[model samples]
Target: MAITQIYLNLPVSDLEVSKKVYTAMGGTINPDFTGDTSAQVVFADAIVVQLMTRETFATFTKRSTSDGPIEVISALAAGSREEVDRLADAALAAGGTEPREAQDIGWLYNRAVDDPDGHSWELLAYHPAGGQG
Candidate 1:
């Protein structure tokens, strides 16, 4: 079967605060999917992100919030490594801070940045063919 969409359930401590940060990161609000307690961020027509409250999030997961950065990173693939670098550059210019310069590793190019809410995001470009432009 082919995948037509992807839904990312992200945990947030505060709904209003997270919404503002995501808005700054270029996410558009969809009232059709929003509710009194949650917001659905549409990254693309086929990609949706559900920002769930912490309490609701904790109900399903059995892990505690870590004191340091999250152990795992989530990345959305870019069409090209140049697009990855461009995205990182734009994000940093738009108040996001870069953890480091975009790095290239043969087939992968990636950069990490913290959104306005301090959520970490990796802007990545992955080439399955094992080469870089």
Candidate 2:
């Protein structure tokens, strides 16, 4: 079966802080699927991020959550290099941390940011034609 949508589930330390970071990254909270211990943030119509308290996240599996290590790095595509910078800047302003310097290679530009809970996100703009402009 073809997958129509993607839901990324992450364990967060602070629910409110996670919400603010996602909002700054251009996501909208889907209240219909949100509750006290969990929240659903929609980035695009087909992309949804489920943020849960570490306690609540344990209900889904026996795997342990670690605050020290990054298990995944989620990347999002932007329409332009400026858009990538905009989102990254917004995320940093909303309590996220920049993990590294921005990367630009003529055809692609990207910046990485980590949320308050330490979830990593990469904002990128790719132009297959070799140059952004």
Candidate 3:
């Protein structure tokens, strides 16, 4: 199946601060979808993340927010290992937390970072050099 677009909604305590963190990590804010309670953060052409305030998000679901445990780890493919490191570093410098160092396993490299709101994001790159496919 070919998907046109994907939007991941996240509940944040501070909308503007979340937008800033995402933008610092190379994501773009879509002013058309941004408002006082929510902001659309676009990472790629088809990937858009909606950052909504806790109060605003509650309108969509009845479940309480899960900001403590590891709810999810959103991973995106990078152009190269350098790009992975760069984006991860940017997130860390902009108030995001790096849970661990970059992992390189011959054909794949990955790094994880948690945004200020405790949203985990893993940046990864695949190198086909030592692969047996």
Cα lDDT tens digits for candidate 3, 26-108? 89999999999999999999999999999999999999886567777898888888888888888777778888888888788
Where in model 3 is the C-alpha error above 4 Å?
66-68, 128-133
What clash pairs does model 2 have? none
- Each candidate's clash count: 0, 0, 0
Tell me how far the alpha carbon of residue 17 in candidate 3 is from the true structure, in angstroms, after superposition.
2.1
The TM-score, computed over Cα atoms with residue i paired to residue i, of candidate 1 is 0.66
**Rank list by lDDT:** 2, 3, 1
Candidate 2, residues 15-115, lDDT tens digits: the string is 99999999898899999999999999999999999999999999998977876666689998989888888989999998999979999888989999999
Better of 1 and 2 by TM-score: 2
Evaluated at residue 20, the lDDT of candidate 3 is 71
Residue runs of model 2 more than 4 Å from their true location after superposition:
none
Report lDDT per candidate. Answer: 0.72, 0.91, 0.85
Q: Rank the candidates by TM-score, best first.
A: 2, 3, 1
Ten consecutive residues with minimal summed lDDT in candidate 1? 65-74
lDDT of 2 at 119: 86
